[model samples]
Target: MASGGSKSVASILLALNLVLYLVITVIASWAVNHGVDRSRETASRLPIPARIFPIYFPIGNNMATGFFIIFSLIAGVVGATTSLTGLHNLSQWNAPNLNAAAVSSFTTWALTVLAMGFACKEIELGWTDSNLRTLEIFTIIVTATQMLCTGVIHVGVSEAPSITY
Candidate 1:
């Protein structure tokens, strides 16, 4: 089992991951809103006939941008829940019930990585911007920290009790 210091570090990392998740959520939301506002402004400037019967939606970005937006929101919820579970496990750090926390952390890590992939695909499809780039980088960093903390927690907890004859 890991020592107290290791447990504390794991807890701290988990907390930091949560904070970073929130930051990503905020930045992504801002970018989405900014994109929508720009689209609206451009639409308003169009000529009367073009505005009256638009042939296509002016989402501006390609298909991957839509996927990126969807996945990022999903990742935010999963990461938040995982962080809460991790904190709960830390509160009961001495218990031999590490499986749930470890599982949640692993799940969050996977989702975050997936979201990063979506972000990359969106960028590749021409959704490049400072905000999107920052979100992608931060998501990768947070996923790494979450995975490390999950490993530390698994090491720190004692094994589950086995039935005896």
Candidate 2:
């Protein structure tokens, strides 16, 4: 068993990681939205900035710009909560599913970059703006986080003695 100090360190790290995750996620979302805005601005077209996005797994057109719209809305709530209370987390009702949200978040980030990069003319596919690869890697990492947490939760609960009908 780990010592109390080590456990405390781990918990702190976990909390920090969650905060960083949400921060980076919101940043990525905004970056994509900015890309959208730039594209529209350059083309002189008007598109409503998405303010809400789906937290569910997005696929095909389901993973469309609509998802970003939903995300924008949710991010606003998350940001407000964090700004007001310095608490960075989901409710217990939603905590176990965070990894899934992360999946959608990173995928949205990647696709937004892709649309703005290869599909649009907002960013150069330079060394740093290698958004596709970066998003891909992030997606993989987030997916792994989901799987690991699922496994840990399964084993943890399996070892418990409680029986709930």
Please provide TM-scores, in order, for all candidate models, with all chains considered together. 0.73, 0.39
Residue 164 in model 2: shift from native, Å? 7.0
Over 62-154, each residue of candidate 1 has an lDDT whose tens digit, in order, gives: 546545665676787778778877888777665444667877888888888888888767666775556667877777777788778877877
Prediction 1 TM-score vs. true: 0.73
Off by over 4 Å in 1: 35-61, 123-127, 158-165
How far out, in Å, is residue 8 in model 1?
A: 1.1
Worst 10 residues of 2 by lDDT: 84-93
Highest TM-score model number: 1
Of the candidates shown, which would achieve the greatest lDDT relative to the real structure? 1
Please give, for residues 49-116, the per-residue lDDT of candidate 2 as tens digits. 32232222221122333343344334433433332222222122133333333343344334333333
